[model samples]
Target: MKFFNRLLIDFAYYLQNSVAYQQKRRFFYNLLENDEYKYKKYFDICMIILIFSSVSILIYEVKKDVHDYLNIFNSYVISFIFLIEYLLRLWVASSVSKVIINQDEYSDLLGREFDLWFVTKKILKEKFEYILSPKAIIDLLAIMPFFHELRLLRIFILFRVFKLFRYAKSFQTFSSVLATKKFEFVTLGMFASIVIFVSSVLIYVMEANDPNSPIKTLYEAFYWSIVTISTVGYGDVVAVSKEGQFVAVVVILAGIAVLAFTTSLFVSAFTEKLDDIKESKTIQDISKNKRVYLICGYENIAKEVAKKLLLAKFHVVVIDDSLQRVEDAKKDGLTALNYNPGSIESYAKLNIDMSVQVKAILCLREDDVANVYTALTVRSINTDVFIMSLLMNSKNRNKLIYSGVNEILYDKEFVGLVAREYVGQPVAFEAIHTLRSETSAIHMEEIAITERILAKYPTVEKLENIKYRIVLLGVHKKSSSKFFFNPSDDTELETGDFLLVIGNYMFIREFNKHLSHKGEV
Candidate 1:
C-alpha cells in the first residue's frame, strides 16, 4: 500500500506540471503568497490603504444624507479590487501547492505521463482546501459588499476592515500571548463568574421582597450585581436598602481586586510577547545591516565572545540547537535563535541575504563535524565573510581549513595558554576597561585598508609622516598563514589588509573615515 501510495503521488506531481497555467505562477506566488517575498510588503501596504479607505466610506455612508452618486461607484471600485485580490490569492495557493508537490520539476526524461483528469482533480482539490482557509475567508468577506444592499448586512461587510489585523504584528502577538496564557484567562473568568453569582444571589435575596426595591427580580438583581462589580452602576438598577448597599460595597471591593490582578497578568504577558515580537523583527531588520557577527553556538566560550563583541557595541546573533539556551541568551539581553546549525534553512533563517553586511561567523561548537559543516555552509552562502572555527581536536584542524575557515583557534593551545596565565588570573577584571568611554584617552580599533588608502600609504614606512597620533600594532591579511606582526617600516600594505591601531578613539574614527572617502589615505 505504501509503494502504491508513493506511485500515485509521483504521478500527480508530474501531471500538475504538464498543465498550462494562464498567469505567471511565480510572479503571483511572490506577490500574494504567505512568505515575505520581495514585493510583498509594498503589495500589503497598498491593500491595507485600500481597505482603510473602503471602511471609511462605509462609515460615512451610515450618516443621514451622506449617500451620493459617487457612493455606489466607490463601492463597485472597492469590491472589484477585493475580487482581484481574492482570485490572485487562490491562484497563488494553487501555484505553491503544485510547486511543493514537485520539488525537482522533472522534464520528460521518460515519455510517460498521467491523464488530464488526474491533474485537474489534484489542482481543484488544492484550490478547495485553500478556499476554506482563514485568510481566504477574510478575502472573500471583503467582497460581500456587492452581494447585499441591506444596512444590517453592511455591518458584517464592515468587518472586512478587521482583515487589516493580518498585517498588524503587535495585534498578532497579543493574540498569541492570550493563547499561551489561556489557562490564566480561564481562571480569572471562572473566579469573576463565581463572584458575580454569589453577589447576585445575595443582593436578590436581600432586596427582592421589598415592593419599592429597584432590583425587583432575579434577572434585574443579576444585572445590578454585574454593573456594581464593574463599577458601572447605571441609574436604572441600584440597591435602595442599607443591607443591600452593604452587599454592593463588598462586590465593588472584590471587583477591584479581580480587575487589578487580571490587569497585571495581561500586562506581564504583553511585555513578554512584545519582547518576542521585537526580537524577531530585529532579525528581519538586519538585512540592511552593514556589519554583524553571527555566532553559531551558545556555550560558555561563545557567550563570552558574544559579550565582548556586544560590549564593543557590535550587533551579534547567536544560533544554537537548545531552545532553553536560546531563551537564556535572549533573557540575558542577547539576540539568539534556535536552529539545526547544519541545515540550509538555518542559514535562510539568519534573515539575511547575500548582500547583507556580515562581518564574520563564529563556529564554536565542540563537535568538529558540526563546526566544519557550518563553516562550509557559511562559505557557500558568502565567499568573502570571515569564518573563525574553534578546533575541538587537532586532527580536524586541516578539515576545517579545507572547509574555507578563515581562521582556527585550537582549544588545547588556548587551554594551555590559560594555564600558564594562572598567576595573573585577577587580570580578567582588566577587560572591563576595554568598554569604550568618552573620557578614555586610548582605544583599540581594527581599521580595514582599501584600494584608495593603499594608493597613498603604499607601505608601513609612509605612515610615519602623519600628524595623527596613533600606533600600528600588526596587520592581518586573509591571504597569509600568520599575521604580519610589527612588520618592517618598508612592508607593503595591501588593499585588503586589516590595521591594528591604538589611539584616541575619535581620532582613529576620523582617520578611517578620511581613508574611506578619498584616493589618498
Candidate 2:
C-alpha cells in the first residue's frame, strides 16, 4: 500500500511537470486572459472532437439497449470523475487567491517560508462549497441525472456533453464575444420581433381561408408564421382562394425584405464588434509579459509619444476620452484602452498593477489639473515607479514637484527652447539625428580610465589603440559641469575623465576593457 501510494505521487508529479500538460494549461489560461487566436484554435479542435465522439456514441446506442447496467455504471463513473475534477479546479483557483492573502499570515505564524505539506493540506481541506456554486451546479447537472427513460436520453447526453466544450478556448471566446456583443444581439432581436409580427398577420390572412390549411386557429398561426417569415413555402398548406393568394404575395415580399435587412444588420454589427475585439486583443497581447507604459491623454502630443515609443520597441498603451483620439491611436498601431487614466477602476481594467516590471508612465494630459490627477493615481498604485509628465502650465510646477513626479516637461518652455536653438544653430539641429538613429556608428561613450590603463600605458602615446577607430569628441570632467571639447595628447588622462568618445560597438568594447583593471568584471 505504501509503495502504491508513493507510485501515485510520483505519477501525479510527473503529469504536472510534463510539457503537454503545461501547454494545455497555457492554452486554457490564455483563453481566460483573452488571447483570441490561441484560445480559439485550441477550443475549436476540442469542440470538433467532442461533438464527433458524443454523436458517434449516440448513433451506436440507437442500435442497442443503451440502458444496460454496465453502461449505466460507466456513466456514473464518468460523472463522479468529472465532479472530482471540477472540485479540484475550484480548489486550485481558491489556492491562487490564498497564496496572496496567506503568505504574510503564514510568514508571521511559522517565522519561515511556506512548506509543501501546508500547501497540500490547504488543497486537501478545500470545502466542497467552492465547487457547488451556480456554475458548478450546472456542471453537476450536465454530468449527472440521466435525462430520459429507456431510450438512452442521447439528446440529453449531447446537451450535457457540451459542458466539456466550455473547457476549450473557442467556446470561451464565443461566450465572451456573445457577452460583449449583447447589444448587437438586442438589435437583432428587435428585427426578429418585427418579422414575427408581420409574418403572423400575413399567415392569418392567407391560411384562414384555406379549407385544408394546418394553420386554421390563431394558435396554429405560428406554424405558417415560421414558414412565411423564413420563405419556406410548404405546398401541403396551400392557400387556393384569390384573397389568400394575395396575402401569399405580401408574405413572400416581406420575407425577402426581412432577409436583406437581417443580412445587412449582421454585417454592420459584426464589423463594429470585430474592430472592438481586435483593439482590445492588441492591447492585451502587447501588455502580456512586459513592462507597462501609460499615456494619460489623447492629444497630438500623445499620438507623437505613441509613435516614438512604438519605434523604441516599448509596449505603449493609451487611455483617453476623445473618441476620435482613441480611434486614431488604433489607426496608428497603438493599443488604446477606452477609459480615464485618473480613475482607480481604469487602472485595474488596464492591469497596471499586475505588470511587475513597469519602466515608467508618461502623463501628458492637456489640462494641468488632469495631468496632476493622472500622476497621483499612478503613484498611488506604485510608490517606487518612475513618472515623467508634461506640465502645460509653469504655474503648476511647484504642485507637480510635490506630487512625486521625477521630471516634468513644460511644453511651452521645452518647445520654445528647441525652436530657439533650431533658428540659432543648424549644426545642433543636425546632431539630433545622430542621437536618435540606431544604426549610427558615431556613438558617444563615457569611458572611465582606471588604474589598469594607468599601469599599462604610462603616457598618452601608448593610447593609440583607443584613438584609432573612434574620434575623441571631448572629456567630461566628473567633478565639474564642464566640457573639454578638444583635449590635446599632452593632456594626461586622469582616473575620472569620462571621455565623450564617438565610436562603433567594437571600439567601445575594447576601450572599456583597457580602462577597467576589472577587465569586463
Candidate 3:
C-alpha cells in the first residue's frame, strides 16, 4: 500500500511539472470551456447539428417505426458522441492531481505528514460539485439512452434538446440576464404558487360534484389553474358553477398582473445588460484581427497617436474609462472600449493571453499613477508585448520603468528641448520639422538586413551603387544596440542590422524593390 501511494505521488509530481501535459490540458480546457476559442464556433455548430438530429430522430420514432439502420445510427453514433463529451467535461472540470500535489507541497512546507484522507475528501468534493451542476446533470441524462438494455431510461433521450443551451450563445446570454433577477423571480414565483394553489383547491371544491363541470379531479383543477394564470384559457376546461366561474375571473385577473410584472422584469434586466453584451461582441470582433496597437487613453497625445497609426494603416484599439471619450474615439473612426486600464479583469476580458495579435500597448493616460498602474497590470498579464508610456512627472520615471515600460515619452521635456533648438537654429529646426511632417516628400525608413541582402551587398560601399536617389544615414547593429553614423565605404554589414536611409517616398520604394529583385535574376 505504501509503494502504491508513493507511485501515485510520483506520477502526480511528474504531471505537475510536465510541459506537454500542461499544454494538452490547457488545449482541452480552451476547447471545452472557452467561448472565445478560435475554433469554438465550428465545434458549437457541430454539436448543435448532432443535438437537433438526435432529437428529430426521437420525435420521428413517436409516429412511425424508424428503419433499423436509422435506429442504430441514432442509438450508437449520437450516444457515443454525447458520452465522450460528458467524460471530457468531467475531466476538465477539476484536476485531482493538482489538488493532491498542492496538498503534499503544503504539508512539506509545514513539516507535517500528508493527510491522505483530507486530500481525498477535497478532491471528491470538487468533483461532486461539478457532477451535481445543472449542465452536468443534463449531459448525463442526454447519454443515458445509450444503455438500450435499460428501456426505462430511454425516454430521457428527449433531454438532448436541452443540450442546445450549451452550444447557443444567445441562450446563454438570456439565461445570464434572467439569472441576475433571481430575487425578483423567486418572489414572483412564490406569489404565483400561492395563487395557483388557492385557485386549484377552491375550483376543485366548487365543481368536484357538479355533473357539468370539467374539474372532476384535483389534478385537473391544478392544470386548469396553471393554464389560466398563464393567460392561456383553453375553453375545453370550463367552470360551469357560479362559485367556480367567480374563481376563474379572479385567477385570470391575477394572471394578467403576473405576466405584466414578468414582462417588465425581463425588459429591465435586458436593458441593463445591453452595454455589456455590446462590449462582449466588440471584444470578439477585435480578436479576429491579425494585429492591433492598443492605446490605453483617449486624451490629446493618445488621440494624435491613434490618428497617425490609423493613417499609416495600422489597426488601433483605444481603451478609456470615460464613456464620452470612448464615444469620441469611435466617432474618429478608431475602435474604442470603455474599460479601466488598471484592472486585471479588463485584460482578461480583452483576451490578451489568447491573442498574439497585440503588437504593442501604449499607456498614454494623463495621470502618472494611472499610467504606472496600467503598465504594471499589463506587464503582469503579458511580458512580451512592448509597452510605451508617457512620463507626466520626473518622479514617476523610475516607477514606470520598474513597471516594465519599454519606452517613456516625456512630452514636456521634448517640447522644451525643441523650443530651445528652434530659438538657436531656426533654419535647421524648420528643415527637420518639414522632413518629419506629412508635407515633405522626403521620408526616413529603416531596412532590415536579411541573409539575401548580405549575400548581394556585403559592404556599405555596395549600397552606393544602387540606382536610387537615397542617402545612407546610418546602420543600426542589433547585436551591440548601437547605430554607426556615416561609416567608411568598406564598413562590412552583417545580418540582423538595420540600414537607416532618407529619400523621397518613391525613391525609397524603388530602392527596396531593386534590392529585393537584385538576387532573383
Q: Pick the candidate with the highest lDDT.
A: 3
Deviation of model 2 at 249, angstroms:
4.5
Q: What is the alpha-carbon lDDT of model 1 when measured against the actual structure?
A: 0.76
For candidate 2, report its TM-score.
0.53
| CA deviation > 4 Å runs, candidate 3 | 1-26, 36-42, 60-65, 98-122, 148-154, 280-290, 308-313, 330-334, 340-349, 353-356, 366-384, 388-521
lDDT of 3 at 64: 92
Candidate closest to the true structure, highest TM-score: 3
TM-scores for candidates 1 onward, in order: 0.59, 0.53, 0.72
- Per-residue lDDT tens digits for candidate 1, residues 345-364, read 88786678544577788898
Per-residue CA lDDT of model 3 for 3-71, tens digit only, reads: 776777789989888999989888888887898787878888998998888888888988999998877
In candidate 1, residue 140 scores what lDDT? Answer: 84
The deviation in Å at residue 169 for candidate 2 is 6.7
Task: Return the lDDT, model 2, position 330.
Answer: 78
The global C-alpha lDDT for each of the candidates, from Candidate 1 onward, is 0.76, 0.66, 0.88
- For residue 518, give model 3's deviation from the true position in Å: 15
Pairs that collide, model 1: none
